[model samples]
Target: MTKTVQSRALSLAPGASRREMLNLTGAAALASAIKLAFPSGAMAQGTGPEVKGTRLGYIALTDSAPLIIAKEKGFYAKHGVPDMEIAKQASWGATRDNMALGAKANGIDGGHILRPKTHLYTTGKVMQNSQPLPMYTLLNLNEDGQAISVSNEYRDLNVQKDSSPLKQAFERKKAAGKELTAAMTFPGGTHDLWIRYWLAAGGIDPDTDIKVIVVPPPQMVANMKVGTMDCFCVGEPWNEQLVNQNIGYSALTTGELWFRHPEKILGMRADWVDANPKATQAILMAVMEAQMWCEKMENRQELSEIVGRRQWFNVPVADLNKRLQGDINYGNGREVKGTNLYMKFWGEGGATSYPWKSLDTWFVTENIRWGKFDPKIDIKALVDKTNRADLWREAAKTLGVPGAPTADSRGVETFFDGTKFDPAAPLDYLKALKIKRVA
Candidate 1:
């Protein structure tokens, strides 16, 4: 029997009693190989490429589920990979730096990293001195999962809420002249972008209007309770944790803003992909398939265990499961409507995994507006650089994933606010914008 078939059989093997593997870390072993005569041609293709070794970097967050899932599931081996080791980084900054200067530099190769960090480094926005190697664009992880949580004190302001809580909340603070502080994971990540976007959407000037700080996800709650921040926009567990502990109340969820916005992407340096194209495609195929498995409600507990494991997120199963299911508990006696904001295990289709060109355009425009990059580069060129739907199509085709992605010549779409985002002609969209850049 071929190795691919052997690997697939192992991955399909039924789980040992659920009691034996509560977290679903590893499925039962594959059946002993039965002597099945294979045709000579059977060994030709469909056997995934050879993978030597990869040093993938990931921060401990619920959204890191995809990487964990890929590892836990035999998706890697099934795709004809040799071995892989996941390196847990201290922080996002450390992760990006490690990729820029680690085994990839002197050892094996650059490991896995966050999508935006890769983009910033490539464009020389975050680090001024170094020229970053571009990373392969793969599947997106979370969409619309960011949450802006506030200390329970906001309830005391008697803020009247209508469509826009942020605006009303800001008005309440202004009427009372109360100072507020909010936090994000990074200056340009979804946490920060969502927090600031929500603030601006409500007519609050994110610059002088309020103080925004950079706090890691694990530290958000502690920082808030310690008076370091009045509120925060961060990924799951932290948001739910605050309410679970009665530390803060959630003001709004980013998922509520647009339902589906790309949050995370599987990232690898361009040099690595160029060096190991087949191996890279194999990893992509495995994760994309794993993502499909994760979208199902039945796989919830299994996924929770894989991502919640001490090695990955180091968080308790109870904490991860709550937000994974979209059930949000806002402080005491309040629960935000449970919604699938995390999109933890999205497949190729639906609201979860498609590479939305318009979405990419919005992210780039915001990056420009925030002064992260000079926006002087041609938006079209940058969009092409940041998004690789063409590469995605090749990987998807290899995996037999249906509905190949097609770039819209018509460009990206316009949002509800009457702001048009054209992926192809980003410069035109930038010129027509009504908002002011940070300068």
Candidate 2:
């Protein structure tokens, strides 16, 4: 059998590189033989991964579920990553800082992060050190779980989906010589973009009309209770906590803003991926399997129980289960039963996990629209550099999942406000926005 296998391998590759030769051979059997022979000296000459320990970072949001589940449920270990370390980051800023530190210095190798921040770091717009950190988004973590929660003061004003009432209140506050403040998790991040778009859609300028503040996700509820912010946008449990505490009400979910909108992503430093491609693929496969588990409706209650532990989110299991089960209470006596727009881990048609480059392009355009980055920068090049759809496709193919219909674009996406974003012409879409900071 050994001689026959050798002959087959040689016939397939008369003259090939060591890696290619191993690929032509039966890689699984050859890998086992190489490990037995070498012990710890060398790896099999194959396309198989170099198994190594990885330190992953995650913030305390419900969308961080995939990474958390991957670690807690032994998916990482089952996929050849037995020494994976899951670190809970204090905030998104801290996650980025740890990722910048890299894995060698006890920092994170990768993280669940904001999609736009990947572009920001790649363009050197975020961390302005002499050396910029280039990052790649391997996959989107989850979609449409975030929401805009306003203070109880707006309840009587009839502020639900439409922010026009909130805008009027802002104007009234300004006329009274007071400031109306709105908060997001990070500047130029996903929450920031959502709140800005929501405000701007109602004819309220996010920059000049109101003050925007930055608060961490875990701190959002406490800050809102103390009247530090009028309205804030963030992920689950925190928003529901506000409603539970009777301090605020959810005006609109992000899903209501843009259905299945891309949110947190699985991000890694570009250099790490370049040096450890196989390890990166291994990590993605584990996370993707965990994502498939998270998408199961029957598993959500158990998921909430697991993620709600003190070691993880530290929130009540009930709060996490509320949104996880798709039961939304607006905290204004309006309840939506069995809604389809809850947080989606892996949506039908591979929508949630696939890192669409066009989505990254849209984020870059929004960043340019908000003056976070220069409009003259090459949007396509930036998207190509940061969004690692190719890597995701490879991982999916290895896992036997269906590939995305297209590599770069997800076609035209329409928002709730009847705004259509054409990925092919991002600048034109930006030009059409009536209430934007850019000219």
Candidate 3:
């Protein structure tokens, strides 16, 4: 028992009844027994993390900052996962392949991954050999800050928040028998969904009117410079770098499409998480702590510099700085100072970190919209198997964090086109979409 409980047990009133004394003593005994059984709060001493560390992979996106910062600032070490490796992944495809291989085969246990990856991996939609790799969605890494950039070829068209102007322009190009392509990191990933949503909202069919292709986040700017793609949606600092290089202008930040939307997540192989629960907790706690650090305005500069180091992103601090601090230069003569569209790592009292099943439902629904998953698939069941919000709550409680989400869902989410996604009725949302591949 703690000192306070012990003191309460000792301080029995002079006229205290025998029953009162017995009750206090009994309560103290139970507390002591419980403490003894589960020492150090959750796990007994020496029964801490089952493993010292695990391999974690990350792309060079700014959203991967939490994982990078966790390793850099010793949060992983502070949480007893000192040997964690934050390896850089070549592309999202590489991430998927390595994830399927697992750490024992020189893959990652998990790090920063796209949120949809959890559903995709669990369902085996994107896995090699069509084999399902059960996974866990631990925590959301960050939100907002991803952008869609249009090539300078369309800069004269002045494509901004509304992409309707591109419809005619793309049609004209296609009429000339020229191939127009839109690039995203993965087929069923966030970038894919964002670009598709933007195009469809403006009356452009993503699959038919324009060719969609997969390009890694880091390669986005380079590919665009060589005229490999007409437009691309990706997380920074590539978009910011594209602006710097004068090759393209950002049509809009993804936040403009859906403010503070769910982006990347902390995902892991389920078998590894199940096998090492304590280690998993340590990793989560560490990343959570790092996320809090990254959210601080004062630390953003250091965050950019640290992640920009040659060993991490190999990017200059300039490409990452402006956006990380909420400064936007659309590169089409539009600039915003200190906007709220900045990437959020941890929102008011850690709300952003809490993994909402509603968001997962939308991802699953969107994937279904694009026919990545079958319409008859059980989204809720798949979400239940993959989402580990219960684990997030446990860590929050252990860390004495207040204001954790009380429910699983974040309620109905409305997008830029005024369409609403009611988590309770996902099919209704899907049916409302006019440009979806789903029948």
Clashing pairs in 1: 104-109, 104-110, 134-270, 412-423
Model 1, range 174-248, lDDT digits (tens) per residue? 579777677888777767777766666556667776787777678888887776676688777778778777777
Q: Which numbered prediction scores highest in lDDT against the true structure? A: 3
lDDT for residue 151 in candidate 3, whole number 0-100:
99
Model 3 Cα lDDT, one tens digit per residue, 99-121: 98889999898878999999999
Instruction: Name the better of 1 and 2 by lDDT.
Output: 2
Arrange candidates, best lDDT first: 3, 2, 1
Q: Summarize candidate 2's per-residue lDDT along 29-106 as a digit string, tens digits.
A: 565444444555353335555655688898899999999999888888777777888899998778878888888988
Which residue segments of model 3 deviate by more than 4 Å? 1-45
Better of 1 and 3 by lDDT: 3
lDDT of each: 0.64, 0.85, 0.91
